[model samples]
Target: MNNLLIGYARCSTDKQDLQIQRETLTSLGVAADRIYCDHGLTGTKRDRPGLTQALAAVRGGDTLVVAKLDRLARSVPDARWIAEQLTERGVRLQIGASVYDPTDPMGKMFFNILATFAEFEADLIRLRTREGMKRAKAQGKLRGKQPKLSSMQYKELRRMYDSGDYAISDLAEMFRVSRATIYRSLERTPVSR
Candidate 1:
């Protein structure tokens, strides 16, 4: 069987475009029909429909092409594991921008080094986020959204409740507040003019 060039493209959100990646793969000699695309999905997920289909279609000695290393996955461990899987199945993994190729010994070494760096960068980001959250909590800066209802609004809510024209849930929905907020407002003394 002739070696087939398969491409995979993914975008994290529906608003983002996958065309550039697709075009890059096509320019690199992958046929338009051979490119599989997944949109509005996260790379963190393992069960992507397009990715699964692309993997299933690939046979031994096939080349699986991606626009970039990150386009395949962000996690270094996951990336390494995926490379291993492809190699075990006799599939060659190629990154358009990276010198790392699973088919070559030097490329494999370079890929491992790059994966290690990616892992280190991810750890740093997680550590920085944790420290920032700790500082914010210490300063009492962590807070939820403020209540939307004003005292006058509370009065109106009570008046509407007294009318009994709407159910509790219905009143909550109409006011755009939660049922708990409505019940709490009902417990308060209605303000006089």
Candidate 2:
């Protein structure tokens, strides 16, 4: 059998289309049968079902093609880890934007440098976000996320507790709140009622 040329494509959300990426890979001589795609899934996650299946299907001489590096993974660390895994298994990775072949020495060097930069960029973003949150907290402007249930919802919760038809767990699920919230709401009910 001919050495397989597998392609992987991913989009962050269901609203985004994978058509363009799929077309690009298909135009690059990758066959339709060998393409795996994950829709409505974040690239940061390592447990992508389509990606896992594609990786497993590849053999020693097979080539794994991605439209771009970022499409495969969100961070440099993840990219590097995936590259290492493919290399150890004698599989080749071909980034459509670059001519670097992961199996080649020059390609490996280039990929490592790129991965390092990616890691640095991710760390910088995280640091900036943390610093921003800290400043907000110091200014007493950070109230955190707003409460999910409104005043009306709280009233309904009280009524539901009074009716005594549903269990606390059921009320929690129906109202999309925690059991603790339900218990607290029930506690606040007037003794006469």
Candidate 1 RMSD computed on C-alpha atoms after optimal superposition onto the true structure: 6.7
User: What TM-score against the true fold does each predicted structure earn?
Assistant: 0.62, 0.64
Maximum-lDDT candidate: 2
In candidate 1, where is summed lDDT lowest over 10 consecutive residues?
97-106
State, as a TM-score between 0 and 1, how close model 1 is to the true structure.
0.62
Residue-level lDDT tens digits of model 1 in 38-145:
898876677788988888878888888888766677677777877787777778877884434576788678777766776676668779988998888789896546
- What C-alpha lDDT do the candidate models reach, one value each? 0.80, 0.82
* Stretches of model 1 off by over 4 angstroms after superposition: 97-104, 117-193
Judge candidate 1 at residue 109 and give its lDDT: 82
